[model samples]
Target: MDCEILENTVLLAIVTLISVVQNIFFAFKVENESKIANSKSSQKTSSPAFDKVYTANQNCTDAYPTFLALLWCAGIFCSQGPAAFAGIMYLCVRQKYFVGYLGENTQITPGYIFGKRVVLFLFLMSMAGILNYYIGVFFGSDVKMYIKAVSNTVSPFLLIP
Candidate 1:
């Protein structure tokens, strides 16, 4: 199979790993906080640690669908390499955001900012790629030719398996 055919699967696996890490981190932190609070349940706790972990987890949960949509759309319509790079960066920043939020809320700023920018970039790329495809379909422009040329130029350097 061509590597291009597997781009979405690779991206999905990366996203799933990031999500699993976040969930595990949240579970461990909340469990530890529960122990310190002398409670068996951390849910709805007033402890600062629980609050931070819950907030971080909730933020990621809220943003996850949108991120996945943009990532997949961009990867499908645009080239895989840039989409994969941005997806990895977004995942890394999410990890940073989780860790930073645990320390100081203000420390999350860098990750938050970068993550937002990456999402925006993915959105733009998706729009451009989709528009290009439709234009080719509607106007008989050789979109595949253009995409093939660009891919041929870039794919050799990407070296995806």
Candidate 2:
């Protein structure tokens, strides 16, 4: 396999590993918190930890497919460097969001803002990549070559736009 392909594969695997670890951590937390919450005298209604963990797990599960799709599209069609960067950022933001959700004042977590922005960035990256790929295909141009040509003249900040 090509070195770039191998590198991107490894990067994707690492991202998957990160997600797995986070899931495991949240699962364990939920299990432990649920038991404690159930045992408490006044906890019959709800447990903050249990609720937070459950919601975080659900959110992660919902976002997993979107993350994978965006990662692959951007990595394959646009460039590995940007895609990997965005993927890693997405993972970090997700982790932070999960952690922040466990706080007492969950409604005011900064992670919510950061995570949403990261998702938006990933979405934009995927869209740009898909557009680039189709434009290259329709015009009988090498996609990578076209991307490179544009990258050479465009500012880094403007690439996503």
Candidate 3:
């Protein structure tokens, strides 16, 4: 395999590793927080911290499928290296968002803002990949060659690195 392909694979592997570890941490935090809340009260209402943890976990769980699908779609169709880099950034920012949500203030944090931006970027990249393929199919263009041509024209100006 080409060096670039190997490097992209490594980047993706690192992202996956970090994401798994982060998710495990989040799960532990949520469970710990829940336990603390339960110890305090048997009422339907949980503690504020517990509520925040639950919300954060729920939001992540809701978005997980969509996020992973878009991530892989962009990685395969767009530039894999950049896609993987974006994935790393997304994971990092998402962790911050999760942690920040557990704080006393529930207002949107910097992490939340940056995470949304990263998600928007990933969405656009995934759309570009999918759209490129469909456009090729409809226009009877050489899909791979045409995508390469278009990507070459656009990538030089991108500040991906």
Clashes of 3: 0
Q: Can you give the lDDT of residue 12 in candidate 2?
A: 62
In order of appearance, the predictions have TM-scores of 0.74, 0.74, 0.73
Root-mean-square deviation of candidate 1: 5.5
| Backbone Cα, N, C clashes tallied per candidate | 0, 0, 0
Per-residue lDDT tens digits for candidate 3, residues 1-161, read: 79977765676667777777888888998999988998888786788888889999887767766767767776777657666767877887787778777774554477767766667766777777788788778996645555545544553333332
lDDT-best of 1 and 3: 1
Residue ranges of candidate 3 with Cα displaced over 4 Å: 1-10, 42-45, 135-161
Q: Give the TM-score of candidate 1.
A: 0.74
Q: Check candidate 3 and list the clashing pairs.
A: none
Residue pairs in candidate 2 whose N, alpha carbon or C atoms collide under 3 angstroms: none
User: Which has the higher TM-score value, candidate number 2 or candidate number 3?
Assistant: 2
